[model samples]
Target: MSNARLPSFRFLIGFEAAARLGSYSRAAEELCISQSAVSHQIAQLEEQVGQPLFRRKGRGVELTVSGRLLLDSVGKSLDQIRSGLSRIETYMDDSLVTLVCPAPVVKGWLQPRVDRLLQEHPALCPIISIDETARYIDEMDVDIAITREPLKQRGVLEVPLLDDELVAVVRPDSDGQPAGMLCLETDLTSDRIGPFIREHFGNLRRLAIYDDPRLLLDAALRGHGVALLSRLLADEALRSGQLRHLAAYPSLPLGTLWISRTEGEPRLPLVRQVFDSLLAYSKG
Candidate 1:
């Protein structure tokens, strides 16, 4: 066989991190390295593969087709490593709280306080996962779950998180009022758009929801139409004056956010740790 060796696992990990985050700077920050180091490692990886993996954008980079194919391999290997580490973790008894919440809840709200959690509980680590809306409470892959509606489970302790108003987000330079546009938001909706629209607004004539909020939100940002976005998602835009609420004073009545545990002393300590942290922030 030839003497040429494969790229190091470390290099693969760096590439995977860069590709997953879509920024070399973020990859460096996450991997705890300098941007130059990340770039060098990616260059080495590309040399090993005999092809360019990324193309430069204005200030960053985008993955080439070859890079996208490599991401699947790297992700699978990384996940396997994670699973092996978790399996080993079961032998040692340490406190770990897993929070299963909605996308915006994870990004907008919980993310801000994660550092504080680490400072308080040095030995405890929090695991967060994104769970869908189709009542996957008990079936969720995490120890604690945040749900919009009460989930049916035996001996599960539930605490209300908060209820925030929905707002509309559109491009700032857009010419028309948000009230006269089609709102695009919500993914994996459990209800029909026609009735849901009428339930929230008396006139269901103008609004419709698509499959993914990320897509619709992007469209809204491009001056398309009003998106019925959660306060969690639209808070930044509202604060920056990039968008406005369609209502005179916050018309939508969004329900409560609930944090639930799997019952009894087995999961109580972990549940209490998260509950105490979130209770201070919850309005409900």
Candidate 2:
């Protein structure tokens, strides 16, 4: 259509809302504008079309014959525009992935491997957050969650990520004295190594109790005391000889890490790609 012949897009939108709703006041509310604004736009649209679109009836308004025809066309065009915009939104979301996991996992494992994953999948964008309070996985607005608790919800996909041993760890340069033990005050303690630590190292002074694994790991790294740390969390430190595992103490099962998501939700390609990369990295 020529520029002069084309109606104002804004006017058309106002007309569509007013016609579909049959109330200029209602349309104004929907469009977050004043009723007079909707009226003015509809007036401009009628002037452009050379015919009245709406006729004032008793206490309300109704579309005229010409208004009805224009409404039909305008509605369909708006619907198509909305559909196109929705598709674009979905496409944008495909490049973004939101991940939630424990603070320890983020600091110790995922953070270290994220650069590699991003490098391999250049289009991937990750938003990582920590949730150590054991919140329900499905309650959060996250694409993927690495949780310690088993998700029993139906239509949720859960993958076994890691099952590592918890061992007493300390800085290599320390005197190796068992002054105290840094402990994580998490469910992992009650489920896996809590009893073992209590029974074996009960007499030793308690160094600190932390809600986050990163804090406990930090205390151990600083040579404050021995810490019962997951093999996965201490992997890099042990490998580089920054921390030493006490051979005298036997390791306990640390518990399995499960990566999960709502199965019914459409999986974005980037989400799947990142999920697979995380699984592989965890296994390593």
Using TM-score as the measure, which candidate wins?
Answer: 2
- In lDDT terms, which candidate is top? 2
Q: In angstroms, how far off is 11's CA in candidate 2?
A: 17
Q: When superposed on Cα atoms, how far off is each prediction in RMSD?
A: 13.1, 11.2
Q: In candidate 2, which residue ranges exceed 4 Å CA deviation?
A: 1-91, 132-140, 185-194, 262-266
Q: Write the per-residue lDDT of candidate 2 for residues 1-284, one digit (tens) a residue.
A: 23558898999999998888889999999999999999999898888888888999875689999999998899999999999786557546767777888776677777878889999899988878885454344423567888876777677789899886888888987784688888888733585566788777787788688887777888888888988898878877887788999988888876788988767544676777787888888767
lDDT of 1 by residue, 50-88 (tens): 878889887778899999888888899899999878755
lDDT, candidate 2, equals 0.81
Candidate 2 lands at a TM-score of: 0.61
Instruction: For residue 52, give model 1's deviation from the true position in Å.
Output: 49
